[model samples]
Target: MRTLHWFRNDLRLQDNPALLAACQQGEVLPVFILDTDEPVRSALGGASRAWLHQSLTALDASLNNNLVMLKGSAQTLIPDLCARYQIEAVTWNRGYEPWTIQRDSGLKAALKANGLSVTSYNGALLFEPWDTVKKDGYPYRVYTPFYKHCMANLATRTPGVLNTARIQMVPHGEQAGLESLALRPKVAWDEAMLMDWTPGEQGAQGRLQHFLATGMGDYREGRDFPAKRSVSGLSAHLHFGEISPHQILASVRAESPADDNQTHFIKELVWREFSYNLLYHFPTLQEKNLQAKFDHFPWETDETFLKAWQTGQTGYPIVDAGMRELRQTGSMHNRVRMIVASFLIKNLKLHWHHGERWFWDCLVDADLASNSASWQWCAGSGADAAPYFRIFNPITQGQRFDPDGAYTRRYVPELKRMPSKYLYEPWACPVEISRAAGVVIGKDYPAPIVEVKASREAALAAFSEMKRRAES
Candidate 1:
């Protein structure tokens, strides 16, 4: 039997159920299509595109250059390829995004109608969004309950499938190569990203092993500190499907004893699952407020403030550092991500969409479900969102989490010599200390764009108005 395996997010070979199924059946032709028909909102971001370019190159090399790269509409391309190759069956790992779900369903129906076998396996997530639901059969809205249920009902994980069968390649007649996708940027803006990341299955496995050895023991506490290496740094790999969550979970279970740090790490992974659950059930998660009262909330539209926040001149040391770090590295510390997000929504009074869109374009680990849910969580407009009154104070957050100022100073170098006393709040630095530190508040580093206390009050007032309007 001749089968074609379509590679979407699941890019790796090992433990890939669909790919393994294809290989075991008979001669398997692996193919990846960069679907151009994706809606603007669902389209791959700049950083994600760059990562995909490198990831696809790695995958192709793993296949011994047998991976067929194609572009344009998958709806048109897949069927055409199946017919051309005389493929007996089509297999793919499922994607949970609303667009992808719709596309796959339609494509699957079309393929079956034409008397071809079509099968899709769950490869992206540990649990299908529908599997871990409330007793009432409705999807979970709050995370704590969802986490508890998932943990209590944790199933025995199957080992990753090892494909010992030789992968047979289809004759490459005229498919365009990887470069034809133009996933890399026209300018050399990706040099820093290239230096920091190794985008492939090997790289993903290496990261997991490294995190297990060095980070997992202290993960619970050290993860909060931006300067620490407690994070797995496998977010991009997971987002790209270079590694499966099952593999990570199994590895963690086998490698570490059940401890607070291990439990916390598992909970963090479950949070990603929660985001997908929300996305699967609530398709408008990326656009509309999950909590409807936010519809009446007053959001300020100030291009000046937006630009300041974007360029990391917010004058809030921690916020600036996080934003600058995102620009330079295409990633940000999770704790700092919260700080920056809170500053944008609560302090600047900007809509969370701004932050979500920016992160979508900038972050390498920018998963749609997590990005949208997190931005909404920060804005207090999502399910299990933070309370509107619980705004993050950038100064205090910096003082607490990034206490040593190492993470801040690395991104915001003007504050390199500023004493810890005023590292987070440079505007409050003494004149003598400022001169000694060779940094000027308004000149060298920006002064705080908005006063924290006043902005907090304004945000509360806006929230009250939203409630008032919603009630009326």
Candidate 2:
């Protein structure tokens, strides 16, 4: 009996449910397909492909340097590989995004048409998204009760590992070359973003070890502050499935019997799970608003505002800095992400979908679940979205999350020498003071494109009218 373990998003060898299940069947043929159907590489960026190539290269090496990397839509290529290799059964972890759901379903049918057996496992999330629902079995709309139900209802678990020694190695297909697959590599990208971070199964284990040893203790307080190295930085690893949420949750649970930080971090991981649930239940969310009322909610379709936001030219230091960080590194701090996204949707009155689409293109950490859920949350449109009227004042947001302005200065070099007091709202600096500080408004940097106070009031008024209309 021979089984092929199809690596969709889950890339790691440890605590991988699908890979383990494949081991139980026979010689595990681990494979990763370069999915072209995904829009990120084609439309807005090359940075993701560069990152993915590196990640896959790293994985190929760790699996005794024997990973089958292929291209040409998984919808077609998967069945071809199965027939050529004479695969008896195909096993893989499940994917939840609507497009993936459809694509995987089609691939499964095609494989079955060829008289192949299929097995799928849940390695993506600690809990399946749709499994945890209300007594009425309806999908969760709000996060609190959803979270409460997850905590109270789900059974306790510790992480499990895949023991390769327990498996019979497949001697055939051992000579397949990765480069023969023609997976593209190396684009003009920020080397620092890829170099500064870790990748692959080995890197994931190292990160889990270090976080549990040094970072997890203070993660609760440190996660919100950008200047603090508090976040686990496991996002891209999670995105590529190099690390499983089960491994993370199990490790956190093992370290402290009752640490609140461990629990908080686990809940955040569950937040990832909840996001996947939303995507699974409401497949239309990727393109359409979950709340249909937003379809008629007049949105200011300003490409200029979007350009300013995307290129870090909005003149609000924190928002610009966050945008710049994402442009340069393809990632952003969680808190800053919210503030910057809110600025686009609420302050700029730009459509939330616009920001979501851009993030989908840029963020290597971008999960369809987290990305869609968060953007909708900011726009007050999807399940558990923030209230429509509550707008983020960019200056106040900077002062609050990035109190010392350490993060803003790192990405916004134009404001590197500016005083911390004005760092968050440098457009407020007088021209004379700015010139003396060698900060020329139009030359060194741009002025605030929109007045913050005026924008907030306008956003609130629009929300108020929309609310009244929705209520009516």
1-472: candidate 2 lDDT, tens digit per residue: 7788888778777788778888878876777876778654223244555567677888777677667777658877777777777778999998887667787888888888889998788887767877887889999988888889888865546656777657664554534466554434445455766767677777877887887777788888988888887888888888888887767776677676567787788788778878888888887776778897787676898888889999999989999889999988888999899999899998899998789878987777777778888899888898988887878888988898888889998998888878887787676787777777789887788888899889989988887777677778
Question: For candidate 1, lDDT tens digit of each residue in 349-451?
Answer: 9999999999999999999999999999999999999998899999899999988999999999999999999998888888999999999889999988999
State how far residue 317 of model 1 sits from its true place (Å): 0.7
Q: What is the C-alpha RMSD of each candidate to the true structure, in Å?
A: 1.0, 2.5
Each prediction's whole-model lDDT (CA):
0.92, 0.80
Native-referenced Cα lDDT, model 2? 0.80
Reference-based TM-score of each model? 0.98, 0.93
